[model samples]
Target: MKNNENSDIHLVINIAQQTLILYQHNKKMAQYAVSTAKNGIGSQQDSGCTPLGKHFIAKKIGASEPINTVFIGRVPTGEIYEAKLGMLHPERDWILSRILWLGGVEEGLNKGSNSEGGCDTYQRYIYIHGTPDSEPMGEPLSHGCIRMRNEDIIKLFDQVEAGTSVVIIAH
Candidate 1:
């Protein structure tokens, strides 16, 4: 295998600054603006808040798909996002381009129950995915996922793989 494919890759999502940094072999590769949950951070299920702590890319979805392709339930919906289409579905939480589903590695904090209900990141369907181009970046405005630009998500998707380590921090 090529060295690039075998190198260690890690992601650090900073909620406070609303940015996601990509690190390869302990060196910074790229950084992208992101929008975290509007409700801020938490681990409880149904909180509609982004879970914080150690995580990993459990699944990488929408490879080779066209940019702006809409996804629902992690499945491509055969519709490419456009301004007109966005206007037609104003209530939709658009998951476009690509998706990097996250699974929390920290138990009782983000992986499992925490004296309350379930806190599993995978179960909660937390992801670093693309949003509509109209949506503002570097702002807390998502339901629970980390929202990125369509092109940016595609770029990030190509550089990382499933099981890549991630750490989401408040600051």
Candidate 2:
């Protein structure tokens, strides 16, 4: 492991600041600008908003893929992202590089069936993944996931495991 194996590692994203911090044993290891949801924060199913409270990485995908590699349905699309690619398909929601698929930790809140409200973030297909280089960071501009730069998502994907804790906060 590149990080201290025994140190408790967790990730915290402050929606208000549009930043994410990697913490080890309560000490900040790194900080990066991130883009949350353009629709803002909420837990309703199909809300297209970022969910609040606790979560964990349920799945990690694309460990060896090149940066800017495109993903569809959480599978790499066998194509790398370029400006021309976006121009060709102007409506695709880009999921690139690596993915840390999030699952809700709070019961009946961020996690169950969509009927009552929100069930699981996993069911919602929420992830922290890379976006196009042209997309501005530190802004509320993503559909409903945490969006990072291709380089940053690659770095983060290497540092955390499937069960690592994550907390999303508004401020």
Candidate 3:
């Protein structure tokens, strides 16, 4: 890995392709298939839809937590997540491995409704997080956050730090 002292990574989520691309100073570092919100991608506060446009990693959660460990409120629940467990709690939104909390940088797009008559979406707690192993990726299937495989998220978590730039492009 070429760790340039100034190597800054950019995470771009393409809603149409259901893919997340990691770039190091405009050069593609890696790309991973992702699963977005089932309701589709949008940026309205509390709309239960993934926000679009420029954002930053406001927080990085689950740094060394074991894979499959359940997380609620960004803290490990001390319970190892299993596919069967998910089946029992079918309504659960499984957030495992790591979490990249996103904050909207655009004013009305995500930060909140603009004074000039636009919607605000940042008040909503949005994230890109790990999902159960059995969950299908490359498909829309989340409340509002982006989902990735546990292993893939772990790898990504290791590569990124807080304040990383993330952009979610609408489909």
Candidate with the greatest lDDT versus the true structure = 1
State the lDDT of candidate 2 residue by residue for 3-103, as single tens digits.
22344999999999999999988999999999999999987778889999888888999999999999999899899999999999999999999999998
- Residue 145 lDDT in candidate 1: 96
Comparing 1 with 3 on TM-score, the higher-scoring candidate is 1
The model with the greater lDDT, 1 or 2, is 1
Q: Residue by residue across 5-117, what tens digits does model 3's lDDT show?
A: 24378889999899999998799999999999898867765567787888888788888788888998888989889977898998888898888888777777777676544
> Where in model 3 is the C-alpha error above 4 Å?
1-7, 115-122
For each candidate in turn, the TM-score is 0.95, 0.93, 0.89
> Which candidate wins on TM-score?
1
Give the Å error, residue 6, model 2: 9.3
lDDT of each: 0.91, 0.90, 0.82
Worst 10 residues of 2 by lDDT: 1-10
Cα error, candidate 2, residue 146 (Å): 0.2
lDDT value, residue 71 of candidate 2 = 98
